[model samples]
Target chain A: MRSRRTVDVPTLVREAREGSPRALGRLLTLVENAAPELREIMAALAPHTGRARIVGLTGSPGVGKSTSTSMLVSVLRRRDLRVGVLAVDPSSPFSGGALLGDRIRLVEHALDPQVYIRSMASRGHLGGLAWTTPQAIRVLDAAGCDVILVETVGVGQSEVEIAGLADTTIVLLAPGMGDGVQAAKAGILEIGDVFVVNKADREGAPATVRELRHMISLGDRTEPHLWRPPVLTTIADRGEGGDEVLEALDSHWAWLQEHGQLEERRRARAAGEVQALALEQLRSRMGSPTEGVLREVVDEVLAGRLDPYAAADRVVADLA
Target chain B: MRSRRTVDVPTLVREAREGSPRALGRLLTLVENAAPELREIMAALAPHTGRARIVGLTGSPGVGKSTSTSMLVSVLRRRDLRVGVLAVDPSSPFSGGALLGDRIRLVEHALDPQVYIRSMASRGHLGGLAWTTPQAIRVLDAAGCDVILVETVGVGQSEVEIAGLADTTIVLLAPGMGDGVQAAKAGILEIGDVFVVNKADREGAPATVRELRHMISLGDRTEPHLWRPPVLTTIADRGEGGDEVLEALDSHWAWLQEHGQLEERRRARAAGEVQALALEQLRSRMGSPTEGVLREVVDEVLAGRLDPYAAADRVVADLA
Candidate 1:
């Protein structure tokens, strides 16, 4: 039954840590597919995680998130920090085939030995990014990345989900018309640890920055001991203002550590991870509602012989 | 302990069924708040549900969804069918306060006793639209609306979610630059029961329609016995094609009935609703991870003393 790809999980993990991008890629492919071997791979990677600093960058589609990610990557390379970029398209599962288009702009460091870049779509059917991204981060982390940058596409619940995963979450914006209100509308304002107004060359960059700061102050971030998010501007396409962006990220990282919030965030992430897995286990045990006790309850609920809450109560009691 | 607003649940349901919009609005407010009375309200409303046909209209911003919904409401009203329009903004909770802006275009129906229009936001903390929208639909259905139109704002996952909730789903598009490719990219191609090119008077209407038809054929909808989604043109702002859209909707509804898909989709929806409620119950029983058996398992997972799957198994065992 052994094949060329079945190269043993421990050996693959060792190779990944020894700077073999092919081995790392193979491991990530397993994660993406939700392979049966993941239990083994995660057990192997578990002891080696918790070192890389995970930073998440999110914005609306037209905002320069990809370009800003490139700018940040080059900056991290300059500092001799090993970088891992995971560009996640929460909206589309077909994006795995289109990585060449996504990565063409980052060809500057495509050959850099210290830079490990990959793009992961939610795969649509394989659970969700909330479940898979953290595991992928673990893959990159155990592979010896000093900093991991997660760039998520689209907005709404995905941004909130990304914020929960990252130690430092960056919300990006541009100088487009009504972009400030646009940011507020997407609920990104509440989740960001740092705010970046990209396209500084545009007419309304400063206005956007001012508006963001005012909005932050007006919110409950004014409470003492809580980190007040900083608004910075960048022309990411030209790689201008990248160092300042890096500086702001480093400052936030430092604040998280000093306030002992890093451990708190990581613990919260671990809790969420465990909770999702536990729920998945319970769901599988309940079996598909296509048949079994779950199906009977659903039928009863449909007939109005039982309320959904009562059906749920019955299912939980049966589970016990 | 009963406040003035604490009108008894069964009486409220009765009043709502007897053409009382006030009673209906109060029931929906209960849904938005996840009120303690919801279990009672849902039990009371369950028998009267499943009679109304729920059609979901969704598209990206500026695609004239609200306008199109208004046009459809007029058609439904002309037939003397009681109409309920629920405009759900899945992206923000603050949208409840801005109903005036959303409803201004629908001022023609402001005085109609038979037409009920309500805007529901996810309210951020109130579970999610998936868990709460069904209850709201039941409120509309039990109140004796013959046709319920659900218009969702934004796109991506929300479109898929609306598709799951509706008996038939209409996806709208505008004739603009790259609008055809935009439809393919958003993953909405798979979910539409009927496709609409809303701004048919615009520059690229014919091309967009052609592009959409070609894309539909390329997809999995060509299977025998499957309903092929029709691409139609409408000048919704002028209300030019409302009757054709209504015809298309009626045809799709008839097809669903003939194929028995209406019953299948409702069963699937009921199963999902019950599944979500069961998971919520289990999560509450597990309690907070701040301190509990769950906290211990999370700590173990963080320390790499236990893999996530193993921790999950331990937690599930503890639940039993």
Candidate 2:
């Protein structure tokens, strides 16, 4: 493969596999930019990806998503497992990019070869998942990381979208942040595969936990898959109770594997790759010269001069 | 115009203008479904649209957006101004169409001839504003409405995109919805032209307002046109202080008009129409025969045989 002197994909991939921080950084940038050889590189790397246990973290802003992720990464690194983090930042309206200052919160991990952290800008994707997210995850997974954690952009709907993308989703809630119970009512309570009462040291902690436990108990018990999604309490900044968090992760992974759900999830993720490629291909093809015929069909449909179904059929025939 | 047996666009538009509830209901459905000739019909109806002051209500779910918009509409109706409401809802994940049930909360306007309401689905667009929105605005705008209110889906970057569309964007905030200040810190806070401390009857109302005011005060003060935006208090559910909300709206609109910014804003909105058409055309062109060239490009790119820019240029060249 043709490679630039400054950014060699093979060298970067190899170094990242060997736990080189700078190489990991370069690899992440290539993935985010959707580099020329992204698909081929990612395809080559897919076999290595299924090994990493993916964790999804989500909550409203200032509920300490970055801080909690940092502590969790530290705990994973301490266990001697290499970790990769993908933190998704909400985009800025003026700049059309993410204000990712949250990355600075994890500066402690900068020198730790075992930990690789990358910030991803949401880039106006509707679902909380970034448009490039699944590809980014594949890149991290192929780079030989033990665990890959994805942090959502902290809006309720985005939290739900991110939950769907991960094997285990943690919905973070804080005490005294106002409307803790209301947030639960608005869909966060339903999407969480695991609930984290973050900043547990704050006032109203017990009440929030008690309320959450009560809510969880009230939920229908029709789908128990070995481990019940637990409500864990932690003061993330102090690195307290992170071990319990790890236990929860391991238990959830084990539960999925024991139930054969892991394979199901992997199948779904693989299917997503096909859909992404189809969408990309579809978008690119829409602008071709042959599009003149389709443009006439659309104009006629909009003008009531042509039937929509008939137009669709004609286009399909033309494709054939 | 060739008229349908059950619903005729011109009749519906004319009757809806005369404060007919059934006519408004039928018209909204036509627009939301993006009925044929909508663009032409809307352009024909633009003059009547100038009467209503459009206000955009947005925030994440659980922030009381519907309640706030309902209250604001109620307050406007009390002043005898005809009000039209558009609530944008998430399209069904499975069906790829919007579930209009989100508007169930705002049915208080159902029997009022002075108020018209419609719900739009984003149809899997992710966070970008739906294609049907502006036309729906035009249909309501033309049918002799006094004020048009657009309520966003309140998820992810939608709040910011919606802000750009509305004449006056009022971002609603509830006291207890997690990270009181930080929720406003991301893309949401930056785009809001005006802030609504919704659920002001709640305990943390004063603090939320103070915090918002502080942030507004600290922002760049050089653009007097973008002066410290106002933060208003409202118990939207109870219809309390909504008159003050309208007063703020009046003042904000007057400010834009006095400085000749109103015309500029309208001009930008006009330009938005052409951009929207392009996007709509793009969606329609997908899956058509013209996509053959795009498929070839993708094949080349996927095989790591062609650069993305080169592929993109080839497609653009065909269009030329």
Q: Which ten residues in a row have the lowest lDDT in candidate 1 chain A?
A: A93-102
Query: What does candidate 1's lDDT look like per residue over A231-280, in tens digits?
Result: 98889999998999899999999999999999899988888778777887
Q: Give TM per candidate.
A: 0.94, 0.65
Candidate 1 local lDDT, B102-161, one digit each (tens): 667687887999999988876543234677788889899989999999888744466777
Q: What share of the true interface contacts does each candidate keep?
A: 0.53, 0.05
Question: Which ranges in model 1 have alpha carbons more than 4 Å from their true place?
Answer: A1-7, A93-103, A123-127, B1-7, B93-100, B123-128
**CA lDDT of every candidate:** 0.83, 0.67
Per-residue lDDT tens digits for candidate 2, residues B1-320, read 34655545577667777777777666666665556656445545654655556778887777777777788878888789888887776422222343555556678787887787776665444334635666667667767777889888565556766776688888888887665577677656677778888888789889889989988777764475664578988876677878888888888888878887665555445344433454344334432322455655545544445444455444444433
Model 2, DockQ value?
0.10
Off by over 4 Å in 2: A1-7, A91-100, A103-105, A126-130, A224-227, A288-320, B1-82, B87-112, B117-128, B131-147, B153-156, B163-320
